[model samples]
Target: MSKTITNIHTIDLVSDFKEITKMRLAVSVVFSSVAGYFLGAEIIDFVEVLLLAVGGYMMVGASNAFNQVIEKDLDALMNRTKNRPIPSGRMSVNKALLIGSTLGALGLIILYYINPITSMFGAISIFLYVSVYTPLKTKTPLSVFVGAFPGAIPFMLGWVAATGSFSIEAGTLFMIQFFWQFPHFWALGWWLYDDYKRGGFFMLPTGKRDKGTAVQIILYTIWTIAVSLIPVFGVTGRLYLTPVSGVLILILGLGMLYYAYKLYQSRDEISAKKLMFASVSYITLLQIIYVLDKYIRIWI
Candidate 1:
């Protein structure tokens, strides 16, 4: 009976840890970082790539754990986040702080071993996400803009990790993801507006689900599309998209734009949800296309 109880407790602890760190989101961020690394690496080093993945995940996880600690009360107020580890009392604050601090330090140290610039950006992402963006959510809608800085870093961080320098190509990747967030998160803000309101987070530009917010979403979607296509035009160094990849990307962007347009027209939850999914698909597909295109260029 004692051994069985101990096993159950261990399982529960594992689950709580996963909830605190937001494992899936952390992994996705690592994925983007890896994609960026692949794009920038002239000669791929598998060991460094593995280190990058682990380090990126640790940094992102630290940010998330800290964010939850900071927003425990606010999280409890929201339906979507009410059951998270800290909010639900599954994990204590002190343990979470230790986890976050340790992970953050470990992550930065590993990244620094790879390169200083990569470590610097990694630190910036954590600070901006936890110190700036986390607090700004309750104070003003402009938090999204502040948040975009950190949110866009993982993609560029990967590139910097591989190259040990920041370049226009890295900047372009950052800009594409940066602009993409407005529509992606706005749609989410729209879909979860009520939940956010419950948590006192104002995520929309207009602070309401009106034509103003919808219009902004549409406009940013357009901006995202434009920025994504720039490299194909030879504007971004070390990056080029073939006509086939460009067309595919255009179709994907247009598909997302269509949903954004529908959200504007209907101003309804369903359309917002559709736009949210479309945005996710767009980013994932775009990243894949960009990575595939780079390798294709090498072969051709």
Candidate 2:
């Protein structure tokens, strides 16, 4: 009976540690990146796919862990993040830093197993994300642009991991994700502008949810939808999107734009929150659809 109780306590402690590691978010990003790789590959390489999954998970995990480490104080101030392991005293800074560095090193090593270029990119991503993007979040809204560089890499990372080189297809993938991030993140900024301000993070452009910021959100959303359909018109070359896929992409984009437009019209926090949620769903579903469109191997 005592041993059973002890085991339960141990499991709970491990769970707390994982919460700090941001494993769930990392897993989602890894899934999307691997799906991109499989879809983009001329011939799927399981080894490269495996390395991507592992490497991507490690890198993202490291980023989140270090983020928690940096924001421990600010995290303690906010309702949404106050109970995270570092801020809640469930884990110490030293422990988190050690694990983050170890995981980051291991992630790069795994990428190197695929190729040196991949390993180099993985290292650069970690440096930019943890070192630059993290600190800049409190300093300027431009952090969004800086962070976008790392955020956009997963899609093209798939292409690189597959082809051992970058090309038009990779560039197209990068551009699609790059444009999609602005509206997605800006919507989040809209909703969290207050909390972010309290934490000294100038997340929203113009520092307000006014017409100018809304206009930018709506414009970027339009571009996101347009780019998602580029492959259908032979504009993306090797990244062809069929007529049916194009229709679905159009529907997804319109659905997302509807929410963005609504938020723009209202400038209400609740509306911004709705748009933010919709953006998450949009990116996730769009990636799933793209992979499935290819998986079924139908022209449509």
Candidate 3:
């Protein structure tokens, strides 16, 4: 039994790496950072990209780790998060804090190497997430508003990291992502209303699953589409969308809005899941299209 327990501990430490949810967050943020860099500058620095990848991972992973720690009890009550490390007792809160602190320190150090502005942004992201967003989750639906700032950072953090400055280019990147978060989160809130209820989370307005929530979802979806199309008319310097990319982005954005509308009409968990999935693909695909447009122009 002792040996068995030791082996289980070993496995859990390995699983902690996975449980922190760093990889997925890193992938998403790195892609956006790359897209932002591609948008803002003619030249790419492989070193800055490396720092962005590593630093972004540390900051985001630390936030997720702290989130799991703060939500450990609540997570146990929710079906989706019940198996998470701290909640399931697979990893200790002490272990989580230790790991989170180490990762955060390393991330800040690496980002400082890239630029002071990037380092500051990374620190602020962690602050907003662990301090502001996590605690606010169960308090009010306004948590989404507070959370949006940190969530939207990656879209522009990359540009600032690359350019060592802020401008309309970085601001444009931030705008698209800021608008996108409302629908993404509200759709998940709808899909997980019951579980969130068990966890004491007030995820939407009126604190209920209803038509008002669905309408808000649709409104945010429309706003996201509007923000996404802004660069098409050449407003953000080198970040302009080519005709081909503009058409592609519009088609993708509308596709997401279509799913959002479907979920609003149905208000069913399955359709909410569908809308959430569509939102995921929409953001990922939009970033890809933006990056592709950047390289395409270089070639042309």
Model 3 lDDT tens row, 80-159? 88988888877888989998999899999998998899889989999999999989989999999899999999989988
Error of 3 at 300 (Å): 1.1
Q: Which stretches of candidate 1 lie over 4 Å from their true place?
A: none
**Residue-wise C-alpha lDDT for candidate 1, range 1-300, written one tens digit per residue:** 999999999999999888888999888898899999999999999999999999999999999999999999999999999999888888889999999999999999999999999999999999999999999999999999999999999999989999999999999999999999999899999999999999999999999999999999999999999999998898788877888899999999999999999999999989999999999889888999999999988998
Please give the RMSD of candidate 1 to the true structure: 0.9
lDDT of 3: 0.86
Candidate 3 residue spans exceeding 4 A from truth = 1-11
Ranking by lDDT: 1, 3, 2
By TM-score: ranked, best first: 1, 3, 2
Which scores greater on TM-score, model 2 or model 3?
A: 3
- Top candidate, metric TM-score: 1
Displacement of the residue 148 alpha carbon in candidate 2, Å: 1.0
Note the residue pairs that clash in candidate 1. none
The digit string of per-residue lDDT tens for model 2 on 188-271 reads 888888777777787877777799999999999999998888878887766777799889889989999999999988998898
